[model samples]
Target chain A: MKFLCTRCDEVMKLAGAQAGDDTVGLTFSCPKCGGSFAMLTNPAETTLVKGLGVQVGGRSEPAPLMEVIQSSVARDTENQITWDPGAETRLANVPPFARPMARKAIERFAESKGIRTITAAVMDEARALM
Target chain B: MRMYHEVAGDGGSDILGQVGKMMERLAGRLSLIKSVIAVASPKGGVGKSTVAAHLAASLARRGARVGALDADLYGSSLPRLLAPEFIGANATRGEEGLFPIAGVFGVRVMSLDYLTGYGARASVAWAGAGGSITRGPVEASALRELLADTQWGELDYLIVDTPPSVGRLGDLTALVPSLAGVVLVSAPTLLAYQVTLKSIERVRALGVPLLGLVENMRGFTCDLCGAANRINVEGEMGETLSIMGVPALGALPYDQRLLKPAGEAGPIEAVERIADALLAKIGGHAAARA
Candidate 1:
């Protein structure tokens, strides 16, 4: 199987069949960028896929959705507030390329603080941290 | 739904997808060599390239299929150093990749000099229009791709001649994470030793095994009387090596015979000794597998 580094764009070839099982995870270091990433056996023969097992920097944390649900529901039982108009406006200011990561970070922050309704102030604090 | 739902719900962005594709490409490139050795120094003009060429030649002479990769992009010297004796017949191209030009003693060679047609005059005039290659993300990417794209056939060893800098050392380590070892070259001068120590620290920080330090130009041999006089600050260099906790592989005296196109055999013997020490330090393919 082949893997390309996100940072340096250099291709690495690994013996995918060596992994054996379909669910096998292979950890490799990019010779070019020195970045470490994991790949799992792809269902299609001779292919591989990412995201099923990728843990950069060796840090493992709670799932993003789990963090949000626990933080938001723990404090306010009935707080189901959606994005405030002001918050949406601020989110629009985020670049399209980074919008997804920025938005997820903001949601996690709001859920942690028991803020079900995201306001401009929440976006302000999220923007600050990022 | 989460706040990021809309953004992520539209699948991932094109940029993220592109990054994923690139990462996959990096993972699939494989090396054919059994052991990869990098020869580096933090400062330039310490005979790092000379040491690399000789090491490659020494290994090849031993019937080991060795390949010398001149990683010094801007100021390449391998082609010039070995060109007289090791002629580049021609670089064959195919669907796989360009074949490395064969050098002296049947050692396969690859360098930017061959690509730019610069040969040994890379340091003097890399480009005709005063063009200079700047260091940055783009250049770094290009270097990485160049290394990955090379089609090196099966070999016993691949000696990489790295540029003088900590960054290039890091990049090489990243490119070949399973490096057999790093052989540092330095002259017996205060400045060169100081920078070499920094390189030692950088290599250690990267967790790459350092084979040992080679004190190049440790002394001068007089051709008239055939007397070898050790240069000054030898004791200080020993202290630096002690502080760094790396063994001194060998000390190569300054031999004027190396300046010629066809290098003399005497000085090259010193390089072979260092290569022997490095192989001993590697402890066979067991350490290489580790």
Candidate 2:
């Protein structure tokens, strides 16, 4: 079951059972922000979720509760570029429309650098430590 | 009530009920995962992560589906510390919870260190890590995310490594709504013990049970004389913890090899015998309760 909550930051669990035909909608109150929202989980295909950072009025605000909870457990914020003054960009936090672009950017960045997501230095450090 | 909630090893579901209720409205399901263990220290360099990592690994080695949360967002070391190739992996977001990065022997790891590209570290130096994603300021935020999205796959334990200072909530082990207990770690130094006691007091307010005390870097044996003296004069300082109503879990003597210039394979397992004994205690407690 895939879904997102803004206040919650990431995936919150789906409580109800999967019903027959077409789409499955599960609802829950976010454990993080204490807000309520519904999730659409299908046995088929991925569910593209809107991130918490993007607000309804087209302004960015705290996410729905479910997203925060999901983000916490699954570590949705693992990929992010943070700036010195204070701006951090994460693919998960990016708007749904931007995910593909973000993923591509990450892929290109990985390729151009001649290093995969896991860095050579970290791998080297691995040898030294082990 | 006998105020049973105040003590660790009490084995009552009171703590569970209390924390569970706090997160109740938020968690959509029964949350099959039981026992969220946070390893914390008010001071850094006390081997908090080292102990927590090994505990997770040891638990997994015993056949439990174990997951390790490298909660120290900005300055995590678990990725570099684990051996072979399962060193580190970042968490992936999902509706259920954060799917942990796989580590050696099937142990799952989640860390922000992996989130920022390895080069992100360089960028972070140029920029900043967007505040202390470390367990300090972001405990509440992180805990919520952990519970909701992590793909733990029915694990027995979730070992969280917290930064030295509690930060926002201060002592997160206590402040966080859900947790079985807190494991306090300290070096043999008197200063370490003093800090540990203070940290424990902070959590006492949250009423979290103190699992026990672990004294790391206790001593280095004199190979020639066999007169095992602690790493330094401050090493003999685990006494206050005993007086404070917290049981001494184990005393890990210092070994230079474990802390050699480059070696970092998990504090040498501390005292295997003590670990086995402690395991027995936990096992017996679980079985008796079961």
Query: How does chain B score by TM in each prediction?
Result: 0.83, 0.72
Using DockQ as the measure, the top candidate is: 2
Which parts of model 2 have CA positions greater than 4 angstroms off? A1-130, B1-30, B83-97, B118-139, B166-178, B223-227, B235-238, B256-271, B277-290
List the candidate 1 regions with Cα displacement exceeding 4 Å: A1-130, B1-6, B9-29, B85-90, B117-135, B232-235, B261-267
Tell me how far the alpha carbon of residue B24 in candidate 1 is from the true structure, in angstroms, after superposition: 5.7
Task: For each candidate in the order shown, give its overall lDDT on alpha carbons.
Answer: 0.61, 0.52
- Model 2 earns a TM-score of 0.58
| Tens-place lDDT digits, model 1, residues B55-155 | 78777778899888878876776766655532322233334454566566767777754443222332322111112222233334444544555566678
| lDDT tens readout by residue for model 1, A1-130 | 2345667655533322234433446566667766776665443321112221122222233222111112111122253335677776776676533443455566667767888778988888877887
Superposed by TM-score, candidate 2 places the C-alpha of residue B192 at a distance from the truth, in angstroms, of 1.5
TM-score against truth, every candidate: 0.60, 0.58
* Count of residue pairs whose backbone atoms collide, per candidate: 25, 47
